[model samples]
Target: MTDPVDRDSRVPALVRLTVDLSALRYNYRRVASVGERTAAVVKANAYGLGAARVVETLRREGCRDFFVATLSEGVLLRAVDREATIFVLSGPVDEESAFAMVRHALTPVLNDATQLQWWRAHRETPAAVHVDTGMHRLGFDYRSFSASIFEGFNVGLVLSHLACADDPPHPMNERQVARFESIRSLFPDAVGSLANSAGALSGMASGMTRAGIALYGGNPFVTRPNPMATVAVLESRVIALRTVAAGEPIGYAATYTTAQETRVAVLGVGYADGFPRGATRDARVAYGASRLPVVGRVSMDLLHVDASTVGREIALGDWVEIFGHTIGIDEAAAWSGTISYELLTRLGGRVARCYTGS
Candidate 1:
């Protein structure tokens, strides 16, 4: 629980997403030990934890491979770094964006036979081919994979995505693995890759695994332990505090009525800052060492919490942890009825991210 900011130094008032760089490095190294090269997925700004900084840190930690979801993200990641192996997961759509892939030196994951053909016709650099076994979002159909679609291009990695690896013993787990293994033999020169964070943790094939959410310490497979670093916590300042009489309504539409004479502490964070609106009266914000229950409904700019039991020392300008340290991301996601990955990825750009440790 080291202080995120320099307590003795002066800094501007802003929402800070304090990141533990050391924890991230430790998680990458730990996940890489599973006997395969770990490609850090920096898609969606590294799941809302700033892609540029995430790639920079991971690169320094010896991560040579990186994955981004979109062409734009690939461009931004390439801007930050040029030497690392940056792969675009969306693959190429047409000739226009394909040139961007070449310009940025991004290796597109060819998902379909058409894109494969498109790349084979227009692409000059090495590209990865995605074969769909299940989780039919991207990648080529199981039937078309054996066609001449991938004949001429220099394929870097024969990739497939995992859908049910989070379930561990899910029937689809072995099915997709078997399918990927079967088809991968067709392309001998290309390296094989299967497994995401969950796949790697589930003892899947020993190929390159793309570590995304788990690298940031989220367990997609809740049954098993999270195989990464500590959860990232977020804290914001309480800008105001006041006493409300019993039966007084709070927030818009008078959704929450105060039970008794209550003390409310207003936090600076709100939905616009990526705090979910569903985080209503059930959510709790941590103040100092004690947890204060958020009363009433969450608003766009602020949320109120009961702090009557909190001492008078707690006042305006005091800091309250919204999701990190005590209130884990899992709890926050549960309260919001979403996964921790959503919570992390939805963290808005308005909130400033501050990095700590090496």
Candidate 2:
């Protein structure tokens, strides 16, 4: 059997993902400038950009707090930084999980009565309380708010999620904020956190702001232009080029046909590499200044780009930017009929991830 390391050294990766730590730090500063205590939400492995590296970068920028979706995610992050406060958004599910959280010095964000009781029974260490302010996903409902239940408990933080913060004009934002304020008042001693990435950018944060997607260069708002710096750049190399006669079909099921004699470049990336297969609608890849529209459906291992404009300038092994400084991630996500969060997190493991600008 061939050694994997030796095989890797012999063959070059077709697709590459470059993460800019400097840009991540810059984004952290931008989110922190929102006038609230900023807590880095490094959940989903920092949105699949590698949690350990992202956490290290954020720590250097003076980020002391971090949030993760699960207890296991918190445990993994705890291994990255011994000092940074890690909050488990899913909280403890049972006794064993609660013990693990206490052992790792992870703070659980109690969402419901069961989690709160679990935390109270196992440990007295400070934990956060999540109040449901209209998202209806997690957190204790506002109608059931009771200060007595947390009388002897050390509630260190009170947070609520914003569902429509991305849609700034949505009336739900104001309503959720109002409900969160009422619930937060009940826990006067605990720190109040009511904003996410979009909320922080739009000046809706309070005591603490949980910055998620925006820190990774994803536009938090739906319509507003992305204000954050670019952090991740995805690129693929051209493996083959061919000339197709007019009326010839290309790719599986012949979804796209050559309207005229056209030059096509076969990229060494596809849905298997996290390039959305459904992005063929209006998706284009960048080669220098020329934008080559993607024609035909994206396959598992390859996709064809209409390189007629670039002509002879394009050659085999030339790299094309899938999304990066030249093409915005949000724009790419739109082409995929998805959101930036999905696009970033869906990046497959086969794609090489390189860290830069540290």
Which one is best on lDDT?
2
Candidate 2, residues 79-163, lDDT tens digits: the string is 7789999999999989889889999999999989998778877546989999998889999999878878887888899999999
> How do all models score by TM-score?
0.93, 0.95
Q: lDDT tens string, model 1, 28-106?
A: 8777778468899988888887777778888987889999889988887777887999999998888778888888888
TM-score, cand. 1: 0.93
Candidate 1 C-alpha error for residue 113, in Å: 2.2
On a 0 to 1 TM-score scale, where does candidate 2 land against the true structure? 0.95
Candidate 1 error regions (>4 Å) = 1-11
Number of backbone collisions per candidate, in order? Answer: 2, 0
lDDT of each: 0.79, 0.89
Error of 1 at 193 (Å): 1.3
By summed lDDT, the worst window of 10 consecutive residues in model 1 runs over 1-10
